[model samples]
Target: MKRVLIPVAFLFALFAGSGSAAAAPPIPVEPTTETLDCPGFQVDAVYTGKAKWIDAPVASGTKKRLKLFTGVAAASTATLTGPAPTSKVISLSLNGSISWSIVLSPEFDIVITGTGRNLISDPQHGDYPGGLFLTVGKVSWSLNAPDYPNGGITGPGSVTDVCALLAP
Candidate 1:
């Protein structure tokens, strides 16, 4: 019994010394920079185009939109960096005038669902969710105005007008 117990203890020690049992070092990630092509539409184009008025004239300004591209490159270099999770809806309105353009760049709550992709144009509302579908690629998303809930169509103070100006 003594001999068997000693051998068991020695075997346990031997297994414990195996490097494989040790935790592996955390993988180091390098910081990377990537540009999401706006496709000249989205927010950037909306600001560029619009009609001017007096009382609440639409201001004129340059707007730009960017979507992150995916794959190994699309993956964010910062392992744990991104917008804080939120559920509130974001609103974007550009009041354009001949001389002035109102530009609002709000950080939207977007979810990444379905196939993994870099950029995806949300079909429903501008409040997009999902990681972005790779197959669908980059598409145009509609921004429904809060002040004026005009269904899916664009109306006064709507993203539709801005998209029209951005039309490529």
Candidate 2:
């Protein structure tokens, strides 16, 4: 349930082009390691993958849309630091493909389809649950602002609490 998306999103921003530039073509992501920010501690995530740009942002429209396919193999390990401290090797692994559609209209919106991990850390909406979830099938989330990690999630699908595997 740890981010395959987090790594992918990083690559996305690198390959992503803004207005006046169409989506970049398929780019292979070199194997790399990145630090992941979790609720309590941090994890070192290593991954290799590729993203194929399917749709460029609409050239002219109030709504900007982008589509793409991504597949990655990601794994992570870390020690819980804030609470529930453990010496056990906190680890997670994921290999999967996903389709993502991002839009900007009234707000920056996203819809991801396929199987992967999603972190929901938004905690300001009246009795909302916050955690990292291994979401299978499909899940949708919206950020309060672009490039923000915390956001609210709402969708129907199989959800697994990843902390159980990583720490508990």
Candidate 3:
């Protein structure tokens, strides 16, 4: 009886220590900022998003699953500068649904889809007011389980020419 109890006690101690040591800690996060530069254009925006852990916290690692969503009415606006010389300014509006998974982890992934809409503008060529207008379809991009330090996001489609009078 004594010999059997000794082995059982030792096994319990070993298991307990291993379990405590293998646990991971939760990862703290704050507001993050990201910049996206389009061809001939640049946009700077803040990420106001919400994140929730899918499981309990650990002591040496982070949560394996996380669900994230963009904040209410979170949007990014920028000015689209046309070709050189004239350097015409076109108001650019970007609204979308952004969701992330495995956030703050190496397996992090993101999916973003911009709400499609027409470009807002009021320009004149020659002597016509409101002679320039353009429309852009819904644009979407995503970052799947990408390779570390070498992942690439998809690009948006080209803008359609709706203002023939302002053609240069």
Candidate 4:
């Protein structure tokens, strides 16, 4: 009895002290439509996706969880369309995958991975209004709020302005 209790107590204490919350069920990203102002026309976009939400207070040794969202946008896609003054309705890839996940470190630094949409829109500062980014491999980016002023992105993926493709 003493030996059993000893192991049990240790296990309980370890988990109890971790200060981490259990992962929640995946959140369904419902289909939504939005219009984006392009250079000369308006871009109508339909977005759909899902994300497995997680909340971890702290990790084992580092003081924060290793990762939170895993199934986030693992299976996601998007559709975009634009007006055509010169021709009929213009459109890009009817269906495109836009999978991505966010990771928070001990220092609270955010790292986003996978192919998806990225926009650092700060009214005070200039923003990078990037549309769909597709890559053969994988794409990742480090986010710093104050860093983006002129609107830019540096990564391995090829950026496709859905608006441009649909524009006439």
Most lDDT-accurate candidate:
2
**Residues 132-164 of candidate 3: C-alpha lDDT, one tens digit per residue:** 222344433344422111111223634443233
Per-residue lDDT of model 4, residues 71-158, tens digit only: 2332434455667665324322211122222344544555544434332111122333333322323444445523331222346655
Model 4 global lDDT (CA atoms, 0 to 1): 0.36
Ranking by lDDT: 2, 4, 3, 1
**Candidate No. with top TM-score:** 2
The CA lDDT of each predicted structure is: 0.21, 0.42, 0.29, 0.36
Off by over 4 Å in 1: 1-26, 41-168
Kindly state the number of residue pairs that clash in model 2. Answer: 0
> How much is 79 displaced in model 3, in angstroms?
2.8
Model 1 residue 32 distance off true place after TM-score fit, in angstroms: 0.2
Per-residue lDDT of model 1, residues 1-168, tens digit only? 000001111111222222221123222133222211222322211111112112222334554433321111111111111222421222232121111112245643221111211122222223321121122222222332231221222212212222222234
Residue 135 of model 1, lDDT score: 23
Candidate 2 lDDT, 1-168, residue by residue in tens:
112233333343344332222334434555555544444544444444443334333455554766644432233221222224553343334443345667666556665554554232232233332344455545555433332322333456566554444552
lDDT comparing candidate 1 with the true structure: 0.21
Estimate TM-scores for all models.
0.16, 0.49, 0.29, 0.46
The per-residue C-alpha lDDT of model 4 at residue 77 equals: 41
How many clashes show up in model 4?
1
